[model samples]
Target: MSTSRGAPGSVLAVDAGNSKTDVAVIGADGRVLGTGRGGGFQPPLVGVQVAVDTLADAVTTALEQAGADCVDHVSACLANADLPVEEEELAQAVQARGWGRSTEVRNDTFAILRAGVDEPRGVAVVCGAGINCVGMLPDGRTARFPAIGKISGDWGGGSGLAEEALWFAARAEDGRGAPTQLARTLPAHFGLASMYALIEALHLGRIPAVRQHEVAPLVFTVSAAGDPVARSLVHRLADEVVAMASVALGRLGLLTEEAPVLLGGGVLAARHPELDDRIAVLLAQRAPKAVVRVVAAPPVLGAALLGLDHVAAPAQAHRTLRAHYA
Candidate 1:
């Protein structure tokens, strides 16, 4: 529980996303001593041990910079630690590294939620390549969704939006659905003349499937230009965001009280006018006391705050940490 400088209550905070990982070492007084950034953590693809090994590289760099051999607590907010069992497994793997005296793992969405709020009490709905929601209270109670994709009753992430845009555009092009501008714009984005050509390119790997997420923003552009189908998709996404936020707020008993509904992830952070305005209207109708805000801070700050909270650090400690990030 002590650092090289003989400081107790030091924390190692980790925010591991699907694309990258960030690590920070904070003293008991909330001074950020050091930080490290490394590749993504994807246990589902690389296996747990291998994934934590990737994290170790960053952790080692951070600890070296901080002049600490270990920390009192390891607070890791990780992507793909979606379910409780997954969190437990990842926690065990992290603990086995002997990086800290204690370890806690949570879905990465909680990092965004915590990052956007002054305290632990708030709801966060993140719409990145995928969508997820989580709510928390300082008392340790939390509400969350499975967030494993369509099978988990979830929809409206960047990937989902891209897929939906393709579907409607394909249907429109083939005369199977109502005519829409998506039929033209979706294909044009890729320099193809027709949806059939775009479809062939996507199917034949001429255009990497990974590029599909790029279509999400194009959908917003079309919506802004008055495309009915594209506009509908944007509105649906807003609906999903509000639905997830309101439900999480209600579950945490924050629906009746004033609470922050923090929007995070690339899609929400972009603040598309249609999506933003629609979410505001719907959330106002559903959770009248909800105050919506898009989180601009890096989520690693949230992981660090959660660590300080775990150690019961004083309010000044939290302020100092926030100021460092600020």
Candidate 2:
């Protein structure tokens, strides 16, 4: 449960998320040699072949920048890699790269857990562009969200905020939902006047799903401005995320007062300091002995930590990786 260094050799760590993919290479002395980034490589949206190709391009680019021809090992933590088949496909693709001659692949949440908490036992809730949680107990039980894309009940992340905003806009226009400032706020944020204009832009293919994510920031703005509807929406968001974390804690029997809970992801990390405070307070209310903390490091750094942790990397390698990643 310590943040000590691991063994010698270069490690290549990759974190592929819904928004972007990052690659980092570190030397034996813990110095980061090179890092590279590209678009999301999820096979669900982008084809599996395309995803693999993009990943290789990213990894190779990092290696070149690091002044290395090859790595000794690789650890890839990818979003949407929930299914076993998906994990295998990615593992094969990465191993094919001759990276460190060995490769291991896992869910990005696990990497986030590694990057944040030093202990092997604990739970991490990630509420980034997507909402997901991954946990590992000392007893070897592990759990993660089913990650059923947007079709399933995945409403604790950035996508959820966008969806909620759009729903509100639609409802306000239709007289079915409450009259909220979202109607005016969303249009102004996107430089449109009415929700109708916003829909027009979306239908014309002028707006991409990625652009939908922009609504998230607007949600924060509206909430801060004390719009009743926005405040309720954000509260719902905070509750959903807390529920996700609680599920993990409950399963591990860590729901007691002394358990450790770590909150992470872009959406939660930004625009939710109060929510973080609220989450900690709520955890205490539910289980007075729990230790809750908001993780500060980006998940990519967590993925890099996984690489070193697995290899028993030496102190030099840890320092090099930290420096390079930093």
Candidate 3:
């Protein structure tokens, strides 16, 4: 695939996640002319064409609002585009839509990373439903993890934490593990009397499996209340976050230099004191020059900024776009 010619200096920026999508139209000078939101993009589940069709809905709305048919480039930071091959496949799919002259596809983690920094020179660790890490430099070099869950040697996402909590709670209830408050709290969260009942409800679909993510926050609550087991789990998550950040920093050759380590996603952005403090302390020990910050900006801004970068927009354009999001 090659770049298609369209309106010069215009961009169609898309940030497509597992649960939702955000699209924006940016003018040459970095003003956001229009924006739109749509349902999730899950190619692995719905197939490539179907997922792109879902994205097209939002793109159509944004283009209508902007009163334009197409733009010079499309910058899409998408979930499930974990590997370079997947990104290429997705890029081709997006380009086929004719929304832009050119398209670049990246893992959604890059949006979080780019959104948190002034320039593309940082690492980002995102821990929402799942955990992933990525790092990038202005020079176009990048470091990343496969981040495909347990089979990929990844752990400590919200769902993973909930499952870990349930495992320990179940064992504790059955005298197979150390006693912990999780045994009581885990079942209580679901209005059950025991881990046995909770287990049965989960197994029998009485409680939808999607609701299990709710347990992750309770684990933090239990830890805050000083349950040793819960605290251990929280601290372990901190370890994993720091470990990934340090490794990414090293891979980018930024470990010895002062670099931003952006924290985004539900778990990390929650500002859980225990997890935050532990991650800070551990990261400081491992990568003393690492500067950490939570990314509060919506990631569509990052996609737009990446588009501007691709087109070589002026510095004022970056500032203008950032101010709009701010």
Candidate 4:
């Protein structure tokens, strides 16, 4: 389990999410020679070929930036590899490209786990383009959710917040819901005077529908201003995060033991005091021995660390990777 004797190989670490893809080329010496980013790579929405092509652009750019042709391993944590079958398929496809001597394709959330903890054994919840969670124990037992979007009874993320914000704003404007600052703030975010105007623009295609996800931040801003409805949304998100973490802890019998609870992704990383405080309080209540942390490093760092784990690189190499990534 210890890789103190330095291995000899490079790591091509990829952190591919729904909105952006980051690729890093790291030497065995733990130097991050270069990093590059590209557009989202969602196979379900855009097909497998398009996703691979987009990934190719980012990987090519990173390798070019590093002045290298390939690496020893490709540690790819991708959003599109939602299901086990998908992960296998993508792993085969990536290996066929000969980008590295070996490859590991996993759910993107795993990067959050590897990035935030030194032991690589803990629970991680990611609330980026969507919310997903995974947990691992020292014994290699794991707990994970489908994270297949709403079909899996999932909620809480930028997308979830945006949809709820729009719903509340439209309802408040129509007199069906309690009045709140969201009606004014949500529209104001897009330079519109009212929620109705924003709705009309969205319906008429004047505003890109995808931009609706951007409204999530306004919910936090309004909540901070003491909007009851906005606060409720934030609380619900915190509740969901704790709920998942608690279940994962129970699954691994780590509930009564000291464990790390790592948080990553944009929503949690935003450092909203209200949401952050609630998560901390709830975790302490639900799993008293849990250690909580919000990862500031990009998930690509986690992917790189996992690659180093695969190659059995020395601990010094991990320190070097962290320092370079720092």
Candidate 5:
């Protein structure tokens, strides 16, 4: 008798992040039968019910797109899906859908790691709407950052960049900190000309926290235009991420030139050549052998690949899975 338990058919894979949620239906051969997207499903904002509903909507759409009747399993990778209560809630909700015979819940970072490498016995640094790092040693030792955005001084993300610019601009305008072009550039971002007017507008509830994330692009643009403060901010963030990777590598004993450093996230995926060069330079200085690659596909696809691996033949299964993804 076989000691392993396997799926009876195909499966559904999901990647739920702070900005967006993606779902894919996969066949037994590891082919992506269909895919779909839904709104952000962070539980803190929408509640678990809302997140679950959003995920169900996306998964149903993927199945419809695939024209598939039944799925034997499900693997959902979601951001902030950390708490045991949250995991239980999500598991119960997905089990109701009966997409497959089994369901597994994991943090979205796990999917990012799986998406970048075949076995994921390495580190993955994700700097998307937020920034985080997760590393898994060959011995099953894992290390990850807390990754909380607000209420945590977590710096080095798109949202974090915007916030930093706002801070610098506020301080510069008040003559309380070093003068920066941000004081002038920020007013332009809001179609205003003066910092005083911008402050008045913000105090009157004209600007919200959600709108703050919009300013991140302006920081990047100003940095590219040779603004010293903006450039410093970007490089500082890059260095912070590199530091996180170094710590993760140190824990995993992958700090040498032998282990690969996998990069996966939205900020990295922007394909900013300058940013890439800067990251490479930092990695070479810090962890020379850490190979960096930008994962092009949704991390949920990687989670689905994991589900496929669970049921498929082992030796050539990875090749077949890669071929299907390709």
Candidate 6:
């Protein structure tokens, strides 16, 4: 008896992240028939099998709800697939499950990139829990980052900004740095009396380490209020984003051409006017022809669009899927 579980005309789309995974199944007609959400697919935390199994659960549910047994293409954009080898491994693993006839696995940043642009060409920088960038040109040229944090020489993400906030606050408290509003505000954020107390709480697990990401916005608030240290940190982040884009533009030989630079992830999507303005000014000076746009679409939309591309869906189908996702 033959035992394949799915039909062959649908597209399976998955956007797997560090915190959660989003899955969708789309028909050839551009109808989004089913969507499902599941746990994080971080292989570093949960082994590959567990992460793949988590993805399987979401994919199985999405297909079951769509009343489809299989799909022709699986397009997944996953977090922590920082290396080419990682993407290859994850792609093979996804293909092994028999959910689709073929599969394409890419860094999660590409999903954000593809979602914001009408074309596949341009650059995208995602600054969420961490930061990552990817760029592609019409001729198939591409640029990307290792995005493995300090080891990869990356900076300017929620965790990185939060670390800066705490560093300056601690210094201000000890008179090693200029007295800024953060000295008062950073401790008050956690309902503590001083930086020392807050530090102790975090050290002793009274305040979970994961909560550090919450401090990034406060860093913005202080910067907005005219704290020199805070302003520098924000500008530094803008510099980092600009550098990544400019380098990509150079790599793809698009520095003189008008190309879209899509910004996504929690940090960029928040649209802090000061940070946005700074990024714009720096980009204008650095890469004169790069057009910047903030991506508001969910990353899953990108994954779905990629799947549509995989099946050679018509341009109208892409438009329909974009609007349906919109």
Displacement of residue 35 (Cα, Å) in model 3 is 0.6
Q: Tens digit of lDDT per residue, candidate 1, span 1-326?
A: 22574256789999999899999998898989889999999999999999999998899999988988889999999999999999999999999999898999999999998988989999999999999999999899999999999899999889999999999999999999988899999889899999999999999999999999989999999999999999999999998999999999999999899999999999999989899999999999999999999999999999999999999999899999999988
Residue pairs with colliding backbones in model 4 are none
lDDT for each residue of candidate 6 in 1-326, tens digit (9 for 90 to 100)? 11124454468899999989999988886778888899888898877777899887888888887877778899999998899999999999999998889999999998998899887899999899888899986555679989999898899989889998899899999999888788889889989999999999999999999998999999999999999999999999999999999998899888999999999999999999999999999999999999999999989999988788777788888898899878
Candidate 6: worst 10 consecutive residues by lDDT? 1-10
Off by over 4 Å in 2: 1-9, 65-67, 138-140, 314-320, 323-326
What are the lDDT figures for the candidates, one per model? 0.93, 0.75, 0.93, 0.88, 0.75, 0.89
For each candidate, what TM-score against the reference?
Answer: 0.97, 0.87, 0.97, 0.92, 0.86, 0.96
Candidate 6 collision pairs? 6-69, 6-70, 7-70
Backbone clash total, candidate 2: 26
Ranked by TM-score, the better of candidates 1 and 6 is 1
lDDT of 3: 0.93
Error of 6 at 294 (Å): 0.7
lDDT of 2 at 10: 65
* lDDT for each residue of candidate 5 in 1-326, tens digit (9 for 90 to 100): 11112236477888888778888877665667788898887788777776688877787788777776547788888888754466677877777777767787767877777777777577878877788888875454777766786454467777778778888888888999778888998887888887787777777878765776677777877888888888888888788778888888888888864765667776777766557788889988989888888777668767886676555535355566576666
Score candidate 5 by TM-score against the native: 0.86
Query: Which of candidates 1 and 2 is the stronger one according to lDDT?
Result: 1
Alpha-carbon runs more than 4 Å astray in model 6: 1-9
Off by over 4 Å in 5: 1-9, 65-70, 83-89, 137-141, 150-153, 312-325
